[model samples]
Target chain A: MGTENLVRKLPNDIGGDEAGKIERVEHELLPWEKRCHALADVLDFHKIINTEEKRRGVESLGAEMIGKLSYYERWIVAFANILFQKGILTPGELAVKMSEVEGRFSDVPDTRQS
Target chain B: MSEQHDHDHDHDHDHDHAPITVDEKPGYFDLMETAVRELLIERKLFGADEIRRQIEVLDSRTPALGAKVVARAWTDADFKSRLLENGRTGCEELGITFYDDTQLIVLENTPAVHNLIVCTLCSCYPRPVLGLPPDWYKLKPYRARAVYEPRAVLEEFGTSIPDDVEIRVSDSTAIIRYLVLPMRPVGTEHLNEAQLADLVTRDAMIGVIQVGYDREAA
Candidate 1:
């Protein structure tokens, strides 16, 4: 499909397209991936973000992000953007928090116990 | 980090001892996950224990739960009818609780018809029952081709259905999930329910492969 038409259609809406062989590979969920999934459940449970909103949030990340990122990666990114869009959390705050998290984990190896 | 993406069973072991050390820098998305989760926790939306418990709940579920349901359906005529009529309540009878609002639809594969499940839009799997979907299920190729070329896809999985039998592809949506109740394999009449459940595999429940009497042969 042309870029124009691909852009017009939702990135996730790739049904009936000619595709290649199936890669029958399985990956165990990483700790972060599990945390992301848990966050999704918590968000939906507390009414902070519903399931439909999260689906639309991932869809709105555009074709590039959709194609580039893995499944849980897209979800975490979408959660950040959706939280920012809802004014529940700011991008600047997330940036600062991410750096803080990065720094805290950098010096400490056993911080994973937290 | 990219090197860690190899197709292997070793990756599954790392999570238990994958410490967040200075030597091992986390990936961009990995850091984002922790950040988003911590930020939400700080906001008091939910507690860390809740996330832990939720993860525990998710981890507890596996294909064994689905297999038990399938085994019950195979042995009990009334349960099979109930399962076909309403999957959620039928599963609840087996004490398999659904964590999400999505309704489960159990499709029976008969001698005349075979069923295949796919989420063409997204990986809308019956997660509460089957745990999480496999990586390939969420990929572009399987999602794109399964709806139109199901037989070829099944062939790739080494499941060849007869041309005389009909292939029914069920596309899972956000509100609905599908689980295929595969027909019982022959020469297993002597086997009990637990033994029969052992023969039922996850791929069989997903409609990719049929339940074979000889597990090693499959």
Candidate 2:
């Protein structure tokens, strides 16, 4: 429990008592979380790509996007990317849908405006 | 003298301001998911009803399935052998079908050894039996510490083992997921399989804690 004389012994160790510190933060799942799980389930049934392949696709997004996303959020992104790659959905259609969703959200008052 | 002390305390307070909080609004990923889901639905890639059904399948899974497997292993020796040999097929004997192609491996904790699981790369879990991985399981600290300093991480979960006991940490991957079958607690000889399962907690199956015999006393 006490952090004294902490040493980073392993090169790959990202966080540990001797390396990065540990902190706990608890929060309820956001709407995107539930939706992402559903999306992953649907993608699983389609069998268009294996879990590892999907995971690699997510990893290919680079660290910045990965850092910004939640665990399941990455899955949804990977699922969508795979769909696009497979020609099931064109990039043009996805762009249109994204703008449509954004338009819907724009009507609501921005809570973070303050 | 009091004014000097007050000035010193005020200086400390200046350095103790609360950290800036990040905006918690949904990001580009959320919008992308919504977009993809809507497009998929529109194109009939999969119906809304199908997604709902799949979610229900995920929601139906719980740690009770894992507890039943553990309790059976505790009572039946042959069943335990089968479970140790082939995790997925053995669980199927008890009517537990693992989701998709993910392999399940059950680690047995003995008197001399303890097993803990963590997925350092991603939160790979035996979701068919244990349901969703807890938030802590997916966090970076637990993932990193579980591999480097398992005993310390176990202690954080309120599990303390003697220095003599060996702690083995398993890193779960996308292909293979691990579940720890905790050692059966002492003084539970009279308990039936159903009764013993009641003592098996989700945390115990995750190897963060041990199953207790307090239910018997109650």
- Highest lDDT among the candidates is held by which one? 1
lDDT string for model 1 (B104-169, tens) is 999999999999999988888998889999999999899999999999999999999999999999
Q: What lDDT score goes with residue B140 in model 2?
A: 74
TM agreement with the true structure for every prediction: 0.89, 0.79
Candidate 1: misplaced stretches above 4 Å? A1-4, A108-114, B1-23, B215-218
* Model 2 / residue A5 / CA error / Å: 24
All DockQ scores: 0.51, 0.25
Q: For every candidate structure, what is the RMSD over all alpha carbons to the true structure, in angstroms?
A: 6.3, 12.6
Fnat of candidates, each listed: 0.76, 0.44
lDDT of 1 at A62: 90
Q: Give lDDT per model, in order.
A: 0.85, 0.74
Weakest ten-residue segment in model 1 chain B by summed lDDT: B8-17
User: Candidate 2, residues B1-218: lDDT per residue as tens digits?
Assistant: 11111111222221111112223323566768778877777777777777666667777888999999999999999999999998999899999886678888989999999998887766788888888888887777887778888887777777899999999888887779888999998888989999889889888988889888865464
Q: CAPRI verdict on model 1? A: medium
